[model samples]
Target: MTSILLDTPNVPALKVENLVVDFKTKNGVVNAVRGVSFSVDRGEVLAVVGESGSGKTITSLTTMALLPSTARTAGVVEVDGHDVLNASEADMDSKRGNVVSMVFQEPMTALNPSMKVGKQVAEAILNHRGLSKAEAMARAVELLDRVGIPDPAVKARNFPHQLSGGQRQRVVIAIALACDPTLIIADEPTTALDVTVQAEILELLRNLVKETNTALLLITHNMGVVADLSDRVVVMNAGKVIETGTTVQVLTEPAEPYTQALLAAVPTLPEAQWDAIFAEERTGEPRHAEPAGNSPLVDPVLDMREVCVDYTSGGRKLRAVNQAGLVINRGEIVGLVGESGSGKSTLGRAPLGLVPVTGGEITLFGGNVLKASTREIRKLRSRIGIIFQDPGGSLDPRMTVGDSIAEPLVMHGVNGKRPGRAERDARVRELLEAVRLPAANANRYPHELSGGQRQRIGLARALALAPELLIADEPTSALDVSVQDEVLTLLLDLQKEHGFGCLFISHDLAVVHSVSQRVTVMQHGNVIESGLSSKVLQRPEAPYTRHLLASVPSPNPIVQRQRREARTALLLSSGTRGS
Candidate 1:
């Protein structure tokens, strides 16, 4: 093993002493981060977790000296013995991507889309190490290979859009690890990936940390991640550190209520497991929508009949979604659960006329969505809102949060056919406040807001026109669990009050279980199962469905504790017998 040592003989790789970051806005100085302090040792992964507006990202950015010029920062941030909080521009510039590098939550935006990924990575090497173009490009290819990209040479030449989300993230990591930095900060690294990919990324990071002896500052809200990867954890709330402890201590014996709540929020079962259960559950005790009652059953806002989505890649025809059929009754929250590439997204998008159906028909509220005219579709779109998985990407960086929320309402001519500017501003503020965000946040850009806040804003935007059918495509997938719970609860309450149909798509069974009344399982574009959430999850019949259910990591602490104890007992008993 290569013995990689930290910079200081005894001091930790990173130490923060009373870090404070404040943003001066139109209203008042928003204390984005207040009096935070922590230390990360070499080979240690320290997770800083909190909801949106909790200052997790701000704290790290301030520590890295990557904060904007207007932001006022006061604190002592020392990384590898260098005092970074007060470091001069020249000093910071030299150490920025060399001694310390950061991999942002969205690698697509972080990386230059116009340039080749290899060339961009090579630029970092050339700027920091004075390497020639040929040498840097060669190093870039090697770095790509090191990050586990198959056919590194070709991959290195490809642009960001040409790669998968997982591959793009890996490339970003490769860039961060290029100079062998002592400290690497990853902010919500696995936000948008599927479970299997998430597991692989986490494992890869763990292995990289071990191989390089790198100190990692992981900023996220996912408790599952903290449990799986973090050696130590710092829980943040409203710019302050509420609690800090080892992963086990924080996860199992949290001292703070916020910490405890955060842990309770992550989805339990993997998507594959849930998909299998969904298919099998259909085979046994299938649930049909209750017949029309005293109150006439509302017509389905969106209905699918034998819908099939297909794609041809590498000269192979791939049936992404097979003859899938489902109905979204008016005001019903229909949960669609499946693994990656299982056709949940395909079905969701089919209603919006975004994805074409190959073999079946899709109708919207007695009208054929596939046959809807451009003008008709545009009119229909006003009443059907979609909130995507990544809120940041869905939002425009150039537009203010208030403007983004108002755009839909303005386009739809809400409140007396395009109300006055003052009225629209008031509506924006009200929407922001309704989402539990401070009204002052309306003036800020998407980049100024936290991930959770951005998602809330995205929801607010979706709700702007008060659409009858709200299609949320993995809306909470990118958010931290605590924030995710809040969003989920918000969605549930919104549905209850507004009485709008919600076609909620997700890969997480536990999350789907929380909000959705009925569940639909799709695999390779075919509807394998459809039933009451309880029936589908509790006693699934299909082998695939059972496997999916089994994939749910056991959340019962007692079970885990007992298993560990039993293993210990067995080992001791065997040792005694041998002796």
Candidate 2:
């Protein structure tokens, strides 16, 4: 490994000393960051990693002088030898885009909705570089192309909404690169992206830093990312830095318990053993068992034969699902694994009649879904459940938790009759208890709950109907690793208790390997590979499947470096540089 410390540096690109930030809340004074210190030299990547609410983001924000008015901060934050904490408002504003810049976590919210992406990037340049609109726009297009955006000229005119999530994030990066700042702070830049897109973006960032000799301060919770990109690392917990070392040292031999725990919580491949451990932890009778005589006559709960789903956008026909076929037998979990735009979501929703299939057949319990009547389809839906990726977006803000859970019951008339208020309320309470939430939490709104709690609420809502099949679309993608473990465990337990076959769709291979007994890999709307989860994930047969597994970064720095080298060799042999 290359030595991270600068030996012949004239001056560091960024530095912090005894940084402390506090916020006065209704409860008390909240210490967001306490006595944190680190530095990033020119061309160096320094990663600060921690769980949610661990003060990693706060430290980066404080370094940028972008903290809220309520925040009280002290100590030093220097960017290119300039004191950020002590800079005047006007000076800080002048220094923001020129000396230091930031790429936020969520590009959709960070970018202006009304502005064109090209104009947005140009505006950042116009603010600091004083270029004409035409010149700035041209430069913006160049930056977009530099960041690997295809057909940059055509894409430049598009609004943020028109771009995919990965493209939007690329636009955000282009904006950050507009001014060519000396230091770049990327906060969870690839959190919600697919593994392939994330790999591309990470490669882009690494190349840009090397070519421009710019320092990068990356703040994220993903240990894999730290292993993949960071030269040095600082581990933080509850507003304090607990460990600091070169990337190899810190990741392989962490000195702090929090850091160790964080690493341990990360999901990895060869998950058959982990699944067995989880099964043993389960109480009572086995949820999955063959009927008497180990019979093979039981039909699958969900079956799709040559399923095709199509859409029309901008006068162009988009084939989202193309002749895909799969089956989920009773009480079995089948993982649908793919990158974004791979038709995983479309396939998951096709059986529920949410997305119409243009051709082919989908059968739920021998009932034709594509050719079923409206009333028949309505009846069919009562036996199906779906858990969306974002619980906050899926749950109605105007409704209370209890009412949201009971809405499906009220509509379906759970017991063949319109349920009374008392009956619905009782069911809601029992659902809450089943998900391990307090009965009192039934009165709370979605916003009142934590991220994990809200996800559990979403689960309760999905399981409220006692359906035979559950379609979980990236349910734990937004949660922390520890929280994700809890949610996964809870999902397994509930699936056992309810005996529901699950179609678990996710872009995370490790997560898919953890809970899925069978796995189906999709690519560009096609089911490329299907088999036992262990064989497909651990020893993938397809080149694309192997590439996906190779792209996932391990928490161990040594292993991650080896994986990176192997990926590089694969790319070279395939006649493609890093995309």
Candidate 3:
């Protein structure tokens, strides 16, 4: 047996060699990571970019020596000369909270709901150091302040739910940095936040890494973040690292086709692209689009006028949605964009009669849906389709994929209208084909497929009734960047062929710009801005619209390089000014 110390000459901050990890299951062994190797130097920012199930998370977990007991791993993970893989539980514990720490993706799930934030952070510090409780709490407040919280003293006493998403993420970062760990692994830290908040967090992390002289391993699917924050980038796919290089090298000239394809998939907000898209819209032909027939368009799909939804909480009437009005014309695609609580979803549901409208007219295909009977609404419900954000939760575990897709057809009395069992199976195959999924995959369960595949299945089910209008709520937000491209493209093609109107709602402006014909910006339950997609996107008039547009991430190497240079110069200048 050999003992490894923390300090060694010529050693990098962290090093991984020939790492392999496997999980045991009922069917067989799932090999997540296979012979992966990477290293991070002191004060260096390294990014691991990959799609879901690419073994990126597993690799990071293995390096941290956080694998479960049922899992088997063989690797050489040397952090500051310590062999983490071969270390005992007690030996690992000593370094786990002191030498290396991680910030998880979902802050809500990571934090303890019942405890105050300051106490939680103080516990981490108390475990690592021999400091008194008061001293630990003082350090916690300092950490919160360092992470950009406005009022650390008051915020520290609040619970997790009391804070916003960005604030919670900052708290998580504060906790991870409490002990001044030499190495930090941030796994999808910005995925849950809006673009503006994400930018701020990335800048904060980059600045902290530089100031503390710490090494950072950032796992993300956002190429923009990679470009702006990472010194070096590594591309992973299917348990392997395909490419690794400096950010400039990878963004400017990539040797691998996959790398190039990934970069291309990220939607860039180039002025020329927006102008051209709008120019086509001006001519009434739309941009980069095929002519879709109105045959599939239904009459009076869903309509709403002067709709308002109000909620009473804590003796205060909060108008989540004001006299907001909307109408989903048959086969016409309308996009909705707004901040976190702008009543977009509320207005979306008003037409379907899902949410109670305080004051407004609601109709479906010219039918009076506002006062329609339950049976009438039920009969027309199948004619309108909706795909929610969480596709997995929306699906049923007890039902197989085939049953789930076929359920709508069977319920609508259309299944028996088909020729026979053989013909019905053919229809199921056709629907799956429409979504670009393998027909044979219908027999498998949803759990077996990736998130993207599940979402496609959700789309398949939504389209089962051949609905005239489709309501998609943040459909692509949960997917990886590469998968999101395929899904968005598929959605556009389907809408073209089916001539079905779509109401696309999302927080992602880039996605909205790419797929939507008309853009509407909402704030505080009011339609602050609305017009042709090209005009609004290219020339935003409202301040909030400008803020939202500026938040979108761009893939252009030159743009990111310039931004990085500007920030670096500002920091240098600020230092001189302070002196």
Candidate 4:
């Protein structure tokens, strides 16, 4: 690409004009992006926010010329006055990493697993700048250090699998910064990371942009990330931009209906606003009423006391859950909140005896779970349900939706006996309808449905046996904001109707606060704090709990900026960085 120097100094670092992208599929033509226009100036962060299939990623990929050959595009994509759309093959190749770079969503998938992270970053530098191997490697270490990776020299020799998620992402950012590109496109950079790690990554990106005066194009579904970093915002839906304005204007005072819906769907920690919105959506109806007759003799659906779970890896014992105790009464929703690897999932599995308990006791309906007989365990399985984090992976790919939902019923012999084919089929249809999916979807495969639809299918299958207790482990983490809202609402509605207790495990504090009556905070396999959601989240006692709450980014830019500043100050005072 031949660079065109603009006469005026006011030219944006990156610009797109009337961009349109279409994909020709066997079914029909799909319009991915339609006449979308945006610009990012030097030292500016521009965010494109949208739900899944809203064309945010498509627009970014087209801008970087990274889309597959099947994608047809008509747009003016320019970086530093170099027209990216019309650039020659060689020019595009040269400009890809030299003038522009992209940090993908999943660093594990983006980084070369076979190679050491340092070597991969060094390769980028060598390919673009023609530097010596030794020099490039040294620069790689420096870049890693710049991105806040501890012991950069030692970490450079480690393969991608050896590093944590946040470290791997830092390596990806290092590679992107290796060439000193004027424009950087970070696509969902922190979506898969824990909140504390997310804060650090966002801080690093913001600092890098400020230090280098580089333009940043951030594509994400996370409104919090947009509020925390972006200076301007572009809201997209159904392959079109519905709103565009300053971050404050768009987040606080969205003019479009789609934008309003998207913002309203985002889960927030403050209960009053969320409850008010939920009440309004339900036509001023309360979410749940108090139980009748204040009974004194009620057994908890799930109860754990001094539970401990351990595993031996490489002859070393790893404690996953230590003295974790909690209680969930019938029809109550209790949230388990923590960062990744904080033993939340392990504790969630204790009720069903999925994880062996080394100490303490777990009781389900007043029956000992740890020492249950085979027959008793089999019986327990029918009354307990689990919703995994990834519905795409958890759902059986080879089975039809009907068979998948009916599998549990087939195994458990619902209603004390094995049901016939007709009964099974009817139960499956009933479940699909209960989850708000059409009965016709029973014949469709999981791959044919969207992420939200697949999650609903998972929920339907989990509830196929009419379980008394549900373990929802990060059920909506991978979904879009609106879809997450839908799933959470459905879960609440179902819990109310069936009066089943729920153990909601998630790292999202806001989401946990919205659906859960009580909250338990865990860190490093230990229960740090436990109390009512309103009290624990609003007036957290433990330092770790306070840190977790503070790390969450708000949708309001001004408030989020203050939170970021306060988090940085706290970290500095503690003489440590992100956990």
lDDT of 3: 0.80
Choose 2 or 3, whichever is better by TM-score: 2
Ranked by lDDT, the better of candidates 2 and 3 is 2
* Winning model by lDDT: 4
The pairs that clash in candidate 4 are: 1-91
Residues 21-116, candidate 1: write the lDDT tens digits: 988889988888889999998999999988877899998888678888779988789888888877899988878778889988889999999998
User: Comparing candidate 1 with candidate 3, which one achieves the higher lDDT?
Assistant: 3
**lDDT of candidates 1 onward, in order:** 0.79, 0.86, 0.80, 0.87
Residue-wise lDDT of candidate 3 within 1-579, one digit each (tens)? 122433443678789888888899998999888888889987899999988889999888876788898789887898777888889989888877678899999999999999999998898899899899999999999999999887899999999999989999999999999888878999999988877678678878988999988889999988888877889988888888899999889888989999999888897754423344334434645323211321122454666666788888899888878776555566566789986788898877777777767787777767888678988887777787788898899889887887888887777646336345575577779989999998998899989989999999999888988888899988998998888999999998888899887889987887888888767778889877776677677666554665566556566556766544433443343353112
* Residue range 435-513, candidate 4, lDDT tens digits: 9999999999999999999999999999988889999999999999999999999999999999998899999999999
Best by TM-score: 4
Model 2 scores worst on lDDT over the 10 consecutive residues at: 288-297
**TM-score against truth, every candidate:** 0.73, 0.89, 0.88, 0.93
* Model 2 spans > 4 angstroms off: 1-10, 26-28, 113-119, 130-142, 150-164, 271-298, 313-316
Q: When superposed on Cα atoms, how far off is each prediction in RMSD?
A: 7.9, 7.0, 6.2, 6.0
For model 3, name the residue pairs that clash: 300-365, 331-501
**lDDT (Cα, 0-100) at 66 in candidate 2:** 88
Better of 1 and 2 by TM-score: 2
> After superposing candidate 4, which stretches have Cα over 4 Å from the reference?
1-8, 271-298, 577-579
- Model 2: per-residue Cα lDDT over 1-579, one tens digit each: 111332337768888999999999999999999999999998999999988988999998887788999999999888887888888999888878777899988999999999999999999989888689899999999999998888999999999999998899999999888887888999999998888778778888999999999899999988889898999999988899999999999988888888888888888775222233223334323233222312122568888989999999999989999999888888989999999889999999898888868999888988888888988888888888889999999999999999999999988887578789999899999999999999999899999998999999999999888999999999999999988988999999999998998999999998998899888999999998887786777655566876787788777777777777756755665667644
Backbone clashes, each candidate: 10, 0, 2, 1
